[model samples]
Target: MKIGILTSGGDCPGLNAVIRGAVLKGIKAYGHTFVGFRDGWRGVVDGEVLELPREKVRGISKQGGTILGTSRTNPFDGPNGGAHNIKMTLVSLGIDALIAIGGEGTLAAAQRLSQEGLKIVGVPKTVDNDLAATDYTFGFDTAVQIATEAIDRLRTTGESHHRCMVAEVMGRHAGWIALHAGMAAGAHAILIPEQPVSAAQIATWVQEAQRRGRAPLVVVAEGFIEQGQEAAHSGRGLDTFGRPRLGGIGEKLAPEIEARTGIETRATVLGHIQRGGVPSAFDRVLATRLGMAAVDSVAHNRWGTMVTLKGTSIESIDFDTALGSLKTVPQERWDEASLLFG
Candidate 1:
């Protein structure tokens, strides 16, 4: 059997690990030949490929980013896209199956392709940890670790200047990154898309921290909004998935916090730093497990299925169930973390 693999959407840590795991497992266990589709679905549409031997993927499990590359290009767009074109392309390339490693948008596309008779399996790859049917995605741990480290560094400078620091982490539809990082970094406040807060409330948290003679550190998700306002954005156009280019919330919140709390404030957007680094021990294990499970599912002809982390085990489920709903940070979790605020 032959397998084609691609990494889609935004790049993150543990992506190379997934490629390594799938390629190694498929070759050793099933004797499957592997080809890599460059730059996500565009490679599939344009018939771009690279031969992936065991030597090609060796020692990449510790590396960040992807060996096959990635992009946000929607597979349903353009004349050469859609399931039929992709299926024909796969046939001509002599590829028997595919393993798509990505987040929600990529999985949704894979779901449509599977319904249209494509032999494909998915490995969940969101740093946001929003995908359902999985307790946590591969890159989330690495992202949280990175964010927490950045926040910890910001804290030292904040205390030296007695300034309020707003650290923005990535979380579009969910608060997993912000919530975990903030709690871990001991931030005075944690803002998220799931829980909107007014500038006044954030100011109050800052003031309380100031009164305690501690520098205030506020961790905000890029998608966090003011209580009555829309989600934060700088008018940048939507991505291929039609989601807004979310960012600058920390910059927006810094002035708001400084003005209200009478403290000098600074904004630090962690941005892609969280995505570009060596995978954490946890992410390496999780991504490897999911990737190997994906090929196992493909071997069994589990079309339309996605390999996911169900508690401690890696399992496969249909995309519909896997993409059913986002795993947003629940109110109870926010409530529990709220006790530490300020």
Candidate 2:
């Protein structure tokens, strides 16, 4: 069988590892040929492909980002979109099955395409770790590690200047990255979309930290909302998924904190810095495991299903189960982390 593989959505660490694991396993165990789709669903729509062999995948596990490239292109759109058109394209390209590695949007498209008679297996990949089906996604650990390191460095600078530093991490709807990284970095305050906080309240936390002679550190998620207001909007327009661009909340709060508390304040947007560079050991191993599990699912002809991590084990669950809802940071987690807050 010739399997077509594509990495869709935002690029992340461990993407190359996933590709390497799948290709190596497919070639050695089943003699299955592989083709990589470039720029995600756009590649599928345009039938753009690159050949994949064992040699092509050598030593990619330690590498960051997808060698095959990626994009946020939606497969159900455009002239050659929808299930029928995609199936016709696949037939023309001789792709027997598809392994779609991506987050929510990509897997949702894969689920629809499978419903429309395409053979597809999904491997969950989200730096946010928001998917409900998996205990954790492949890129989440790497992102957290990056964010944590950035916050740690920020802490040192904040102390040096006696400044209140607000560090923003990526999180559209959930706060897993911000929560874990903030706690790890000993942030004085943590803000997330799930918890709306007022600028005044944050100032109080800053003042309290200042009282203790500590430079205050604040970690905010991109989608976080100030109290009694909507979430911060980037005004940069929406993506292909029709979701608003979320960011700049930390920047917005920096002035407010400085004004209310009269403290020297700075806002550092971690931005795409969290997405680039080598994945942590945890992420590489998890991504490789999911990649191998995805191919094994394909070998068994398990279509419309995705491989997910369930605690210490990697398991397969129906795509709907995974997409039913997002896995958010629970209240208990926030409360536990808050105990250390100023």
Task: Indicate the residue-level lDDT of 330 in model 2.
Answer: 93
Q: Give stretches of model 2 more than 4 Å off.
A: none
Per-model TM against the reference: 0.98, 0.98
In model 2, state the lDDT of residue 215.
97
Q: Clashes in model 1: which pairs?
A: none
Please state the error at residue 247 of candidate 1 in Å.
0.6
lDDT of 1 by residue, 170-229 (tens): 988899999999999999999998898878888998999999999999999998878989
lDDT of 2 by residue, 1-342 (tens): 999999999998999999999998999899999999999999999899999988999999999889999998888788997888888888999999999999889999899988888999999988999998889998889999999999999999999999999999999999999999999999999998888888788999999999999999999999898899965647678877788888888888999999999999999999999999999999999999998999999999999999999989999998878786998889999999988888
Report, for every candidate in turn, its global Cα lDDT versus the true structure: 0.90, 0.92
Task: Choose the strongest candidate by lDDT.
Answer: 2
Stretches of candidate 1 exceeding 4 Å from the true structure: none
